[model samples]
Target chain A: MNWTVRLTVNGEPHTLALDDPRVTLLDLLRERLHLSGTKKGCDRGQCGACTVLVDGRRINSCLTLALSLDGAAITTIEGLAQGDQLHPVQEAFIAHDALQCGFCTPGQIMSAVGLLNEGQAGDDPERVREGMSGNLCRCSAYVGIVEAVLDAQATLAGEKERAA
Target chain B: MNRFDYVKPATVAEAIAAAGAPGAAYLASGTNLLDLMKGNVVRPERLVDITQIKELTRIETLDNGDVRIGALVRNADLAYDASFARDFPAVAEALLSGASAQLRNAATVGGNLLQRTRCAYFYDTASACNKRAPGSGCDARDGENSQHAVLGWSDACIATNPSDFCVPLAAFDAVVEIEGSSSRREVALEALHLLPGSTPEREGVLNPGELIVAVRLPAAARGFARHARYLKVRERNSYAFAVVSAAAGLVIENGSIKQARLALGGVAAKPWRAHDAEALLAGQSAEPEVFEHAADAALREAKPSGDNAYKIPLARQLIVRALAAAAQGTPSRMPALPASPFSAVPGALHDA
Candidate 1:
């Protein structure tokens, strides 16, 4: 039996009419919606390469069924930047060389964004490393990753202060 | 994955009815269920999504101070709840320490307990796993058994329950609240999981369509709220399943150990509670010698596998060390699991 699901993917509304309920959110994103920014490294959820923010919480998209998240507001890697301007986490990643192979960058960036949104992350490097343990960098680019997160936190805090 | 109809129910009763549908399985969070489905280990014809049963997501402390944790409470939410974390640090630490933050954000308290074992043989359909296909003969029984069970393991299966939360729940002496067709009931958290006796396929004690709505943590468990510590000995420092983890809590007054609660995970098919050891610790001085005696008595029933025999001493040291830390209200650390044989001890060897 098929189900119709309404999802707000990357701030865009999508109503998927499908016949297969086994289509995971990852598949629905890449195959149906063509939002291929969310990488699928390990579909079993062991690898966080398929991470995306569902309702502002980072979750392994591969492990989530599409029908289960009807009307959910999903934020993929593609949704992070604003036109020519990159998200602070994204800018900090490049400034810090956070990626070697760039395969895990999207998920890593999304996870970092989700971490900042949760307010659990501090300017502390060790805390950032622990909080971002879900996103693995097989390339061992952790030093850069930690640096980027800290720098981004400073920039984000400044932006908030300016806004206030 | 098999073709399954998806049903999202608005109420617990409706969810139970959906579960009655042919080969129905309740899906919460889907962190565990989706993985099982992808592996073809469990093929439910219909997934009864119970996340919409809004009432089941509540986390409330009763007037009596007993805590009721709703079944759908996300692990991340529970871990970060200031009130809950302060009330049960061991339980909260265990949750945050178990899975990746992304996974914790999606995994639910109910699914954490009901998730199946991570036995390689069980997941490999080509391999013989009695738990997956009963009477198939367990391939992990004699092969790659290092991470297998060291206690309460049968010849049919040598698998360990991998939940970090269960150990602390056992220490808390929590009660599992369930809803059935006619009425509601509660089962002690220690009894919530059954040892893989002769029938390894029969994992939990829940009847068909039975729903775990919430878990009630007794107010008495607050004794450990300040002194409790959960120490997991795993392959890596973080985000790995335990090989042997101990949840220890001690209440001391006037230089005597008044009460002790201890439980071990990743060493058995179920969370092994050290009740006898805890009972013996009452009124005894919290000394290294007395703690060693308690640790030994706790592991007396341990029947180790061929390669996992190292877990016995590892678990013993962990219990003693955890108890000491709990007595002092500090964190305890141990070497990683899968260590070289005779590693928990330095410069000491031979059969005891």
Candidate 2:
């Protein structure tokens, strides 16, 4: 049986007819929608390589069934960068040299954005490290990742203050 | 993952009816269910998606002062709720201590209560697991069983419940509300999970189509808010299951204990409430000696199931440490790392 689901990805709405209910959101994004910014690693929800923002909350997309989500807003790594400009987190990742293999970069960036939005970690480096413990980097780029997240948080905070 | 029939039920009655068929399972966020399906550990012929049921997403305090948490409420939501966290700090700490932030945001409270054991043998489909296959031989009994249960184990199977949230809930005497096809009933959260007897397959007390609608915390549970803590010892600093975890709550007046509640996790098939220990602690002056005796009483019946004799002593020490921390009083805010031993009050390492 086909299940129809409506989702707003990065701001663009798409109504998809899922042929199989077993298709996860990660697969739907990479395969059907052709938006492959989200990577699937250890798809059993252990690894956070498939992290994405669902309705403004970071969640593992691989464990979430596409059919279970209807009228939900999804934000993937591909959605973070504008036409020529990158999101603050993406820019900070490059500035801090947070990527060695660039495999887990998108997921790390998305998770950092979501963490900043949650506003729990603040400027505490230990809290940032604990908050980002879910996403693993096989290349051991954790030091750079932690630096990148903190920098991005400061940038976002400064932007909000100036706007206010 | 298997391609099963997807049925989105709009109401509790409809969800029950859809799940009444054999080989049918209820799907909330599909955090654990989808993982099991992908691993071929569980193969349901149909999945009744209950996420769209708006009623089950609420977290409200009833007029009687009882906090009713909807089954579908996300773990992160409950932990971050200001009032709920203020009332049940230990529970919030325990919730944050479990799985990563991403998983906690997606996983529901009901799903956490029903998650399967993390035994490697149980996850490996090639191995024989009595809990997975009813008549299958138990491979975890003698094969790499360092993480097996230390208490409440029969000859049939040996496994421990892995939920950190259930530890504090068990201590606070949480109640689980169930919705069956024909009627609704309630059961204590402690009794919801069954020990591995001859039938290790029956993990929970729910019938085939019965659904966990909500979890209710009694008003009296709030009394422990001032002096409550959940401490977990894990292999990693974070994002890991507890080797031996404990939740301790105390009510002190005039520098004497008025009431006490204690529960241990990663030690038994269910959240083991230390009733004897609580009884021993009542009316006693808060001291190191008193906490040690309570720990002994709590672990009096604990015995190693396999190669996990180390768990017994570890649990005993954790119980004592948790009680001592509770007596010291809960922190004004949650520790940065939730329940980790590393997250304990700074400069207090001398206590350990």
Candidate 3:
């Protein structure tokens, strides 16, 4: 069944002609909208490689049907930066050496942003480890990833406080 | 993925009508259902989208203090609600402990209630999984049976119900409000999930078109939640299915256990509530020895497969640990390691 789904990707509005009702949100973003920053690792919920923020909540995009979210706002890894500048999470990832092959980095950053938004990004390493357990790095760069999330969380908090 | 037609139902009647199709399945959160669809485990020709039914998304409390949680309530919403957290902290903890934050955010209460087993053999399409295909034979019975059932398992299938919320709901004696098109009925939460006896394909007794509207937990659980705990032990510290989980609640008065409720997972086809064990706890003081007795009683009927015999002793100690923590009102406690009772069993040497 073909359906037209209107979605707000990043900041711009898009109306995708979904020919297949079985198309996943990840496929819709990557194939239809050409937002390939979101990689597909397991093609299932096991890996966090397809993580994206739908209405400010991190979800496995591969497991979400695109047609189900008709008017939802989706934030992908491509939407994280502003004019060649990286998001605080992306900057923290580069500073802390949180990636090796960089396949899971985008999902990791998106999940980290979502976790911080949910107030789960604590300064404690153990708490961060538990909060970021969903995003797995095959390169075993967890120590650096944990450090980066904590640093990005502090930076995000500072930016919020300064703005306020 | 196979092509499927989808319809967004606006009301409960429309949802029921849409779901009345032989090849129709209701899509609430699409967390597990979509995974299964992509895996080719379940192929539905049509999907009845019930998320548009706004009334099913509410969570409220009755005038009598019973909690009525809508089926469409997302796991994260119920897990993080301040009022629910303050009232039923154990239920909140149970919801939080099941899946990752990303999954919890997308998983609805109805999806969690009807979540499929995570058995390795059942997921592998090439393998013979009776749950997936009737009369296909269960390969997990003799192959890679480390996580298979140790209780309430028949030769047909040994897959356990992979639900953390169900453990506490069984202990709370929650009532499921089934909303049919023309009739409404109530089924106890414990009875909602059936044992996989002969038909592993049939997980629950809900009619095809009937929708689970809400789960109503009695007012007793509100008071009982103060002393309840849901302890889950898994292969990893997080993001793994339970190796053996126990939900326990005890009402102690004057240093003696007046009432007790116990439910176990990862060791049974359904959430195994130990009635005999709870009966033994009444009028007894909450002590390590008493907890051990209850644990022993719970595992007395356990029939473990050769490779997974370790689950027997492992589950017994978990029950003891969970009960001990509940009796003491401890928020967190480590499960005590006991010597494996099945160390002598053949092919179970890894547990020794």
Candidate 4:
């Protein structure tokens, strides 16, 4: 059986013909749309290697079925860059060297960006750690990842201060 | 994951009709169901995706000053809601203490409650599990039973319910609003989860073709606003299953205990409420000795397996510590201080 799912990916509308019920958004993005930036490490919800945004909220794409997200809006790692310019989260990740093998970098950056947009990046490091515990890295590069998130928060705060 | 038929129903009636068919399961968030399907733990022939049902996703206030939480409310949204934190802090804390932010955002309230046990044998198809297969001999009784239940166990199954949010919900006298194919009825949240007396395979009392509409919490402990805390002791500091956890809510009037509700998780087949302990603490003076006595009374009937005997003392200490902390209105104890930069545990850390 095939289901027609209409959803917004990045900033564009997409009407997908999905067949398998168990085929997740991670599979759709990687296999169908050729957006292979979202990696699948564990292929389970335990690892956040396939984190993406649905309706502006971060979720594990590996656990989400593509047919269940009809009329939903999604944002992948490819959507984070504005043509030539990088998103603040991506720039911060690069500046802080938050990636080693870079397999889990995209998911980590996307989760951080979602957290920041959700107003979760605060002064408390414990809260930040609790919020970012979903995404895992094999290289054990948590210090750099946490630093990047904090730095991006500080930069955004500074920009707000200048605007004020 | 294998291919299966999918139906996205917009109404509860349609969902019920679909679920009544052979080998059909209701899907809300798919956080746990999809994971199990991918692992071949559960292979339903048809998935009735009910996430699009708008009526089941709302959070509204009832006429009785109680909050009615729809089944499809995301864990992340419930944890961050001001009303949930103010009224039911234990629920918010438990939800926040469970999975990471990304997973929580994807996990729904109903799915979290209906999630299957984390027993290794249940996941391993080679191992015999009664919950996974009827009349299949139990392998967890003598083999690798560390994470198995200690309080409620039959010769058949020892798998523990994995949801942390359910402990507080059980203790706080919450009610589950369920709509079945025949009629709709409300069951107390404590009664919703069944104990593994003999039939460990039947986890809940929900009948076939039944859909959980919402969870209703009654107004009971309104005065105990600040004197409540949820303590989850897991392997790592975050995103790990509880080794032993306790949720305590105490109300003290004139420096004496007026009321108390305590529940233990990760040590029981269901969210084990300490009704005996609550009876022991009622109308007693608020003191360390009383809390210790209550903890002792709660564990008096606890029968643990070989490797899980440590959970008895660990749960006792957690109960006492949580009660004392709640009485004093102190923040939850941080096992390990957070390091400067945010980092997930380097590898899979075992429970302490």
Candidate 5:
């Protein structure tokens, strides 16, 4: 069943011709849209490797059918940055050395962004660990992942203060 | 995922019509359904995505003080709602305790309640899973029975219900409001999930055309005994499936038991409400001995599988601890050490 889905991706409007009902938003983004930054790990929604923002809320793109999201806005890891500059979360990941194999880095960043946007970034390590538990890093680099999220919170707060 | 026809139904009537059709399934969040389809556990010819129905997305308070949670309410939203936290702390805790932040964000309340078992055999096509293929055989009965059901399990299947939210909801006497092709009716949350008796294939009582519009919790807020807790013991502290879990809600009035509601999970085919234990607590004084007796009553009927015998003791201990903690307004003991090699390190960060 082919359907025409008009939605905004990373602030740009797009009209895609989606033919397969089984093809998910993750597939559309990676295969059709050529946005390969969002990696697919488990594809069963167990792994958070395909996490993305749907209307600014974190969701497993692998679990979301492309036809279901007709007019929904999507933000993938490829859309996280403006021009050459990285998002605060991306910068924090680099600063804290949060990645090893880097396969799950995009998902981690996307989930972190969603968490931070929800104003759930807390100072407690346990709280951060629980908040970021959705995105799995097979490299087992969680200590750095926690540190990166915590660092991102500080950076984002500092930026907010500067703007204020 | 196999190719399938998808229809986005914007109204409850449309959804019900589609669901009534042959080989059609309602798509709430796609957290469980899509996963099963991709794994070849369930191959429906048509998927009716009901998330677009605006009526099923609202969460409101009824005049009777009962909370009405739309089927489309995301687990994350329900977990974080201030009203849900205050009125139904158990529900909030259960939602938070299940899955990871990302999964919760995508998983709807209805989808969580309807999620299939996490048994490896059910997921693997090569293995025999009666739930996936009726009368095929349950490989988990002999293969990896550690996480299989210890209660309400038949010879045909022993896969445990993987939902964390339904346990607390069942304990609180939640009601499921369903809209069917012919009529609409409300089914108690406990009755919403069926036990795996002779017909292990039938998971719920909802008809083929029924669409769960909302989940309504009964207005019995005062009965929350001094101790009410949901204890989830799992392989990992976070992001792992529970090996055995218990939800205890007791009402202690003047140091005497007014009412008690106990439900067990991970060790049962359904969110098992301990009616015998609740009956034992009736008119009894709140004490360690009473809690012990109640736990014993609950475990008396338990028939554990070979590898899942540990769950019997674990469930009993959890019930006692949950009651003790709730009595004192705090959980007394930590979760038991995970038997699996992937045990979560205490106070350490592990990705879900």
Candidate 6:
């Protein structure tokens, strides 16, 4: 019993036939679609290493079944840059040295992008820290992660103003 | 995860019909169910995916001022809903205080209500948990049970419900709308979960195939919007289950407490609504003495099930602290940390 799921990944449409209903979004993206930029941490919802933007909202991909999301728009870590130009959050992470091992950087950047899109944190560092608490860096890079999120938030705001 | 059949139903009727199968379970966002499945704690032969049902995703306010929250509404969405937050501040705070932002964005209200306990024994397949395997004999009674239940637990099971959102819903007397195969009915949120008595396996009041369609807050629940608070004490500052938590709402008139609602979490098999405390505070002044008596009344029947006796006194103090914060009134905006004790106003704990 193969279930078909249609998803738009990184602005590309993909129609998949899943033979196993147990395949999670994390597995589908990494093993099937070969988008390994999304890391698999705890596999449980506790760790946010599998975080991605699903329809413009951040969610844990490990806990989400691929079959259930028939028409979701998924934005993974691979989707964050245009040519060589990194997204604002990606650039900010590098500018702030927000990664030591870089294992959790993709999840952190995707979550930070989602946070900036939500626009609830504003410029407050406390809010940014609280909002980004989901993505954990075992390197204890939280100081840099928080700074990067705040810096990226400002960059995105400025870009929006210039476009307007 | 074990292999399972999946069926996405487009309507509530179809979903209930699909779930009528013997080994079928309703699947919302799967934030909790998938985790349990991966741990081999729960394995259903069939999953009735109800995520695509558009009717179950709305948060509508009725003309009579009652707010109806669809069962599929995400935790983050419900917490950020402006009018929903304004009318039910404690519920919003509790929602925000729950799991990480990503989990909250994917976890639905129905999934949160039906989420399994965080009891270590229940998740361990090697352990003998009556809740997991009926009549297997409870191992939590003697094992590392410091985080077990302190109230409403029996020898059969000592697990506590670990939902921050449910604390405030139980306090507000929220109603759950259930759609059965043939009809629909309502159950009080307080009565939705059962205490782990002799039969610890029976967790909720829902029939096997009945689906929780929505949760409704009555018009009267809005009366406490001005003075409501949800306070949680966790091992960490955030992203952790409550060691002991409380939701307090007060309706004060001219410094006199006209009505009060209090409920305790992380201390019982179900959300422990403190009705006696609510009764004790009515017509009394919002003073420290009244709060102390109410807190004591709230924990009157709370006896520890294991080495977790510390939770009894901790829950009592949390009740008092939560009530005192409520009397001071809800903040104009939710604190950056939501319901964490660290988010409390400076010196509030000392004053309490």
Tens-digit per-residue lDDT, B73-164, candidate 3: 99989978878866666677678777777899999998888899988788889999989999999999878888888987888998888888
Put down candidate 5 lDDT per residue, A1-164, tens digits, no spaces.
47888878898899998777777899999998899999999997878999999999998999888878889999998899999999989998999999999999999999999988887546656677777878888899999999989999988889899999
Record all residue pairs in model 2 with backbone atoms less than 3 Å apart, i.e. clashing.
Answer: none
lDDT of candidate 1 over B1-352, digit per residue (tens): 8888888999998888778766899999899888888889899988999988899999999999899999999999998898888778788778877888899999999999898898888888899998989998989977888988888888888998999998889888999999977778999989988888778998988988899999888999887776787777888656788888889888888879889999998998888899999998988998999999999999998877768889999999999888876777633321121111223331122122
State the displacement of the C-alpha of residue B41, model 2, in Å, after optimal TM-score superposition.
0.7
Worst 10 residues of 6 chain B by lDDT: B343-352
Per-candidate TM equals 0.95, 0.98, 0.94, 0.95, 0.94, 0.98
Q: Chain B alone: TM-score in each candidate? A: 0.93, 0.97, 0.92, 0.93, 0.92, 0.97
Docking class of 2: medium
What is the DockQ (computed on Cα atoms) for candidate 6?
Answer: 0.70
lDDT of 5 by residue, B118-202 (tens): 8888889999877788888878877978878888888888888998898889888999998898899999889987777777889
Summed backbone clashes in each candidate are 0, 0, 0, 0, 3, 0
Query: Model 2: iRMSD?
Result: 1.8
lDDT of 5: 0.82
Name the regions of candidate 2 deviating beyond 4 angstroms: B344-352
RMSD of 2: 1.7
lDDT of each: 0.86, 0.91, 0.84, 0.82, 0.82, 0.91
Clashing pairs in 5: B225-B250, B225-B251, B227-B326
Top-DockQ structure, candidate number: 2
Q: State interface RMSD in Å for all models.
A: 5.3, 1.8, 5.5, 3.6, 3.7, 2.3
Evaluating just chain A, the predictions reach TM-scores of: 0.98, 0.98, 0.96, 0.95, 0.96, 0.98
- Candidate 4, which CAPRI tier? medium
Tens digits of per-residue lDDT, candidate 6, A1-164, equal: 77899999999999999888899999999999999999999999877999999999999999999988889999999998998999989998899999999999989999998999888889877777778889888999999999989888888899889999
Ranking under lDDT, best-scoring first?
Answer: 6, 2, 1, 3, 4, 5
lDDT at residue B114 of model 3 (Cα atoms)? 89
